[model samples]
Target: MSDEPDETPRLDVPVGMFEDIEDLKSQLAQLTALVEARTGGDSAETVEAVSADEEEPAGGDAEGEEEEWQYPPFILLLDPPEYDDELRGLIEWVEGVLVPGYLGEPSADAKWCHRWFEHSVAIARLHAAWLAWQELTNPVSCGNTGPSVWHRDHLDPALRELRGAAGPFAGCTKGEHRVEHRLPSLVPSAWTHEDGA
Candidate 1:
């Protein structure tokens, strides 16, 4: 239940449900492929034909691929700038800059994407809350910013409530602490001391 004006409903999801299903499917497929590769006993001509079938389609156009090999990276664009050139620049940077920045060589079939995406959602939400705190709380670093002798100082209690309602997934230890530590660094502040003493 957010107080924000938007009426979008939030959907809670399990972390490992998709991963488990995918792992089972991958294992079964690989096992079947290994059995066929061993039992078929390919001759030189058969191997050449299989290799040709594995190659890019006859048209030589890389854009559209056949159903047999279809694992393309998605280019998702969130609200881009007003200029068309800038949008094209964003797409180019995603392809040239960001994709190549990752270490190790990767082909279209074996990109290092899913490995980096598991905990990304949690980090994104935590960053959003941190940004909200930074904007709303004056005295961003340290000073009499957040608690100016007036407004009901329920910030800490409110944070505690927010932590509890987030519905942390199973096997996640100290999710609240991870969220709380984003507020302040290694120094004691007004929020650290109890009773505002």
Candidate 2:
């Protein structure tokens, strides 16, 4: 190796790095704005200050200040109005993103219910899976294997249950949607007997 002060004008940085950084900055800005709107300018700074290593004060929460929940609670735990709203968003993601991207070519072996919302079991399962996906796919806190973990641990099982024969969509077919897929009731209903029995 000759030590003759090479003048090749080498470029060290990878291409499109600045663009990626700019995109991240844009996302952060949008998130900050959303936080501002949600908190009504009270805890706007909290978004910018958010970090994995950040610690709360020793004195606990400040006087007259309530601590905020970072994310929405489980969909099942939400009240009617909140449940409706969250369900709408979840439907958007499931229909617009998840099905189109992850769901392979449809067949008799792997069935998908077009009217999936009608199935309570499917709703609960998909909501849980979606929540896991949101947490696992967050780039800031999650490692590179986050998506893989989500797919293996959360998504696959949910899909298997929803699409497999004898699953939630047992009678559903690609050509036709079955609206009356009902769960068997093991216990007799007391109200059905009348006289408040």
Candidate 3:
């Protein structure tokens, strides 16, 4: 060995690793397409349809040009949980905007409420828990008893209900081990009906 240390970092991937990754990606895309086709719903098409339903034609003569599709307002609040300012903003938006807006609408099916992971109500609750988690884990904030208070008052109870055996994803799994489960959307009819009545 030479006295001089090597400065460059080396990747020791197998020669065929890149090709294997590409093949896996291709398989995933195909599987995604298959699932979309089976469900009779594509995200792009759904957005387009929702836009068409909500928009008014500017003029009858403008039909020659394609209309720009706009996503539903709920899409903005459907992001996965995060740990930064984005999570704080999402918590505020969900609490101040989404919760109130959803409450004003007709009540959702109780049967479908079991599917908490797929529902807006559950998302809002989960966001609240994530916010609490941030406060509890922060070394400089929320006091020393913050974590205890959060667990006793918020996180434990919420998680107990949300992840219980009788919870929304009850049919999806029996315990902690993940199994193949076909979870319908929060709206039963939306997933069941191709016309989306």
The lDDT leader among the candidates is 2
Q: List the candidates' TM-scores in order.
A: 0.19, 0.58, 0.30
Ranking by lDDT: 2, 3, 1
Write the residue-wise lDDT of candidate 1 on 6-110 in tens digits: 867877878998899977886665544443454464556556656776685677655445443432211222223433443454445334533465324532323
Candidate 1 residue runs with Cα over 4 Å from true position: 1-121, 137-166, 173-197
Best by TM-score: 2
In model 3, where is the ten-residue run with the lowest total lDDT? 105-114
Worst 10 residues of 1 by lDDT: 70-79
Candidate 2 accuracy as lDDT: 0.77
Candidate 3's error at 153, in angstroms? Answer: 1.5
What RMSD does each model have against the real structure? 26.8, 10.7, 22.9
Cα displacement (angstroms), candidate 1, residue 125, comes to: 2.9
Q: In lDDT terms, how accurate is model 1?
A: 0.41
Q: lDDT per residue, candidate 3, 115-189, as tens digits?
A: 343544455566676567655655344446667887787766665555555544344432232222434456655
